[model samples]
Target: MSNAPVYDIDPATFWADPYPDLARMRAQTPVCFVPQLGATLITRRDDIFVNEKNVDVFSSDQPQGLMTVLMGQNMMRKDGDDHMHERRAIFPTVSPKTVKNVWKAQFEAATARALDRLAGQDRADLVKDFAMEVSAEALKSITGLTNMDWREMDRVSQGMIDGCSNYAGDPAVTAHCDDCTASIDRHISERMGALRSDPDLSLIAVQTQAGLDEAQMRANVKLAISGGQNEPRDAIAGAAWALLTHPQWLRAARAGDISWLQVFEEYARWISPIGMSPRRIARDHDLNGIALKAEDRLFFMFGSGNRDETVFARPDIFDPSQDIAPAISFGAGPHFCAGAWASRCLIAEVALPMLFERFTDIALVGDAPFGGWAFRGPLSVPVRLR
Candidate 1:
């Protein structure tokens, strides 16, 4: 075992709010082993920013990791040329040009339709009612699984996400994840037949036309759904909660003092939707005076890094005035989120603006709750729509 300091934490407490413990870890031991997580956590901002790109030392190619085991080997679990190859294969669907020319209008229509549906309601759970609907519909267009309803898309995506993060080896979580992957496989199979006859620029269609085998196509699309559905879902709802709570900032944006893109960037920094990225220690090496062994589990704590006091002023506060260029919400490495541009377009350009425009008097109903550390977001944002 390495000589790194050991930090013990109550799993339940950490799950609810990891920032306090993460802050201590960053201040005391940047590289320490967390027994509960069964991985060495690198918690400092600069350390993760610099080391995440050092693929040779801290590698993403974890063959035995949970994501690969449950979700199959997606591009996120690969390194170097292998990762770029899969990324290029699906570029047609997620590329900035495609997102602008093709997806932008679709995202706008979806957001508008969702807003119309909620127009009659005076109160709603934004997470389930609004954010989930818009995120899933946009995702259906991107993944070419228009056959699956928005609810099923959200359900299966959450299942696979839970399965990937089931480090405790929960049998129920694993079983549900299996079912979700199976469901996704069936959807992909059904969609492939349609795409062959009438092709489109969706992830499944483009990958199939590019001659990627069935397994790769399934894995890659699953990968897209896993992050695509939840991250945007969370961000859309969470950002709304942030603005409603901080009316001053909301007023600034409404007055054109700040861009909605800035709000998204700041909120992403404050509470990262994708909080942690797990890695495997490819070879024996020392990181920040801590001895690490080959094949040992490691985690780049992006949530902690974003809140590192040395990097961002008022790191804990959700203030939009701060410079957010150092934020790694989309990650800072080879696996830097592939769907970032799409997410930005959906949430910042279409979802947030149109949402406030539709319901100008929107306000929180009671309390909006948040959970999870690995994948963090508002669990539910109860709001008064009228």
Candidate 2:
């Protein structure tokens, strides 16, 4: 409706403060064709996904932006039989039961160590000190890089995710992304080789034991890193910020004398790091009355969806007792974020306890500056603590 530069938008507007814009867009039209991205993005929760009948008109297999270059033919970017194959190979590693059993201890131990590091610190940037450290350790541990430096791992992973948002927008970014991808490939190949030769008690070993083809294993590792790297870590940091700011949520979460997982749902709703899932339609489609052609790029604004007035009461304000938290940060479709359960486990173990123990107080020191659009998160969370 308005001739605003929605496509070429700042990360802060969308990540730091996206509710108003999303409300304006969602209320006016759930699906409006954006010429810049050449696709209609569905903004409403109800009309967010196309039904089974119209599924053929809009396919998730056809990739866009950095995905086209990076994950051109990856399992997620493939359709039909190919997509199903990849999903099967990767599903066991990220399934909820697997995460709850196998990864939970490692995640909690890593979280405890990270929290100990900041036990008596006067003040700290949660993003730099706790969130990144905790997440990096858990992730590297899962990948069998137990001896890797957490900071170095953080640098590489954060660089890759942060680079994704600006890669297509700038020549320098595009070049840097090429370098990053090469490094990730090398790391994955080396790990794959290790799994191939000397088996260990790791997911890599599990994949190999499950009779995954060499190529499939390689692709699965890369896909796991790409989907679950900085995004989930940022979310962990965001979750801590939410708990610290809302003592009720933290107190309730810690008081497992009751149901705590419900509090996680609320905390996650407050600070969803992946504010939106960007996708490109594969064919011509009618999206909520809007005519969209093939290869149209759309952003499913999770930040907006979580706070939709039509969906939630008083969308802007945070509520720990929200009966429903409809956030699409993971995504919503056939390719709806395969690693959702593992990520939630990581956050549950890492962020919740750290907030409960270490920091007595956590508040926004100033205006929060967000990372790029693709990786939705605050770059820093300055807080005053005891």
Q: Judged by TM-score, which candidate is best?
A: 1
lDDT of 2 by residue, 1-386 (tens): 22223433344455556555567777775555444343345566655543311336545455456654653356765666777776776666677877788788888888888877777776778788777887777777666655457886776665555555553377776666666666656766667667668865455766787787766665555556666667767776666666667677667767764334555556555555666565566666655455566666666656556666777765666675666645555665677777777777777655665565566555667554665434567687777666
Query: Which parts of model 1 are misplaced by more than 4 Å?
Result: none
Q: How many clashing pairs per prediction, in order?
A: 0, 2
Q: Which TM-score value belongs to model 1?
A: 0.99
Query: Which pairs clash inside model 1?
Result: none
Model 2, CA-based lDDT? 0.63
- Model 1 / residue 338 / CA error / Å: 0.6
Question: Candidate 2: which stretches are off by over 4 Å?
Answer: 1-16, 35-39, 50-55, 200-203, 210-216, 256-260, 325-327, 360-367, 371-373
13-51 per-residue lDDT for model 1 (tens digits): 999999999999998888999989999999988999999
| TM-score of predicted structure 2 | 0.85
